[model samples]
Target: MKDDDKAVYLGTDCGATTSKVGAVWGDGTVVSTKLLQRVTRSQDGPAAVVASWVDAASDFLSQHDLTWDQVHGAGLAIPGPYQRYGVLDKSPNLPDTFTGFDVHNAYAGALADRAGRPIPLVVGNDGNLGGVGEAQHVRGRGHGTVLLLAPGSGLGCAFVDERGLPLDGDTLAGMEGGHVPIPLHLLGAKPYPCGCGRTWGCVEVYTTLSGLPYLLEERLEKYPDHELAKSGKPMKERAFALRTLAQNGDPLALEIFDFQAKALGIHVAVMAMAVDPRYVVIGGGLMDPEATSDAFRERYLGVVRDTALPLLWPAQRTTLTIVPASLGDLSQSIGAALVALYRSRS
Candidate 1:
């Protein structure tokens, strides 16, 4: 453990199911991260959410025999749009109680109350933090630009620069890469309605877990021999079964992910054209750094690499590296800590 007298900061990721708190040092080192189940969830409201982080940080400090005086700053990460730094605009994952909430106003006072002096704070989107966390995982420096694409409930995107700081546009953090217009569709496929109410042309329509069944429907109808062709299972159940079959190497299932990888690759290529990132890290529920175990995901990511790489210029192709995020779920919390450390220095 680091010296107790040294300055420490709390970096937190307030995710949908759990809240993660990280103790961070000046040099972007995450000393420890504690995961706390957020009981009652969004119904608990923003004040309760802030209180939980304080209490969690307090518990950690007390347990380690550390003093609040060592806590110099804090950082928070969450999903959805923000009005500005420390002010949430709206988050579908969160309750309306946080709508238009001035987080900077509340969080500053909360941290100050515990530290017995003013403590600085920074707020950011989780996806942006993922990029920050991923960049730190890379060894050494000169990582000019790092881009992270997370395909989970939806397609989550994060962008970080050579300095290991998120280049979040307007500090909203969540770049909403999912809603970017669809650049390509394959295998005679048509637009399969998106959650954003777009009937056509949204990358999310292909990348999201929730929308998978619909995406599979059009393809499955043509292949009557596919086991899932006439399945009566619910959407979630069908999606799971389809993935299971894909893992087992079913032809139709394998074909589905091939199509998905292409669409995902196209989306990433579109982003690359806008912001040329040297590193592309893909990790989430779908992919990871080492993927020998999950054959389906491994193959899918292979196609992603094959598709996105050739789209770049021959010189750019050799420079661009596509890999998976090493830190997994904790990346966001580590990122939040890094953001706090950076801001405190400034």
Candidate 2:
């Protein structure tokens, strides 16, 4: 690829609550990362959100003392289920109006208005891009396969092939991982409510921001008269207290977190068996070191090891290596920038 054809490698990651941008150099190094507050989806529709993205892009370029003329192409990492190809069906944290918006056309239009020149733009699902970034630059580079889990507002998954390419064309790999059914019987509990409006158990219904509230509320009911649950404090505030208590080594807090961790392990182990990935990189907003501590990781692994299910563990040394993503919070942007850099070459 000619240097001129390489473009600026402008990339954008429009997430549930944050939007980020970054630039990838010709040598595959990601530099000049920036993140702005998420657009207000409640008050703004898809058009307004894209407009905000344009504004953010302009600011990013100005901050770096760069010009639109230097940009060769742009790439976007958006949330999953791009309606029917390069479009969004629905984003829980984004405006509902974006359900059918054409991503390629929208971005091309936005950049043209801002730069006064047309540039090729491509879009991808954030989960798949996260997997790509981690596979190529973080944990699984040169490995056979990798599984990426974004465990925050929801549990997102992406399977990357040996070439560090996402398995699905673009959007199919990451949107439905959270919807995998869970066996309430194995959990030894009542069927939990899922965010998908079902009473059956699913990963996201208990693992996401929405699910955290439900988990906390159930615990609150169990200890209604406890100090943390007293007075008119919000349920979420009390939940934070539970987190604090867990950090401080409270038994009750440990129990609650353990239950959740075990549930997560079940999901991870299933994916591991299905793909036998070389590495599993975990990310997401709530994947803070605080929420998922070493003890939690150990417990999660214990559950995976103790499963009686077939092929849960093999005699051979398993090649799968689980690790936390090293990209910090700017991974989406870096992934997006890489997408732009590569697609422009193609």
**Which model scores highest in TM-score?**
2
- The candidate 1 region of ten consecutive residues with least summed lDDT is 33-42
User: What's the TM-score of every candidate structure?
Assistant: 0.83, 0.84
Candidate 2 residue lDDT tens string, 144-248: 677877766666677877765676654354436777876666667666676555577777665555566567666767777767667477765666666666656
lDDT scores of the candidates, listed in order: 0.74, 0.67
| Global lDDT of model 1 | 0.74
Error of 1 at 10 (Å): 1.7
RMSD of each: 3.5, 3.4
**Candidate 1 pairs with clashing backbones:** none
Number of backbone clashes in candidate 2: 4
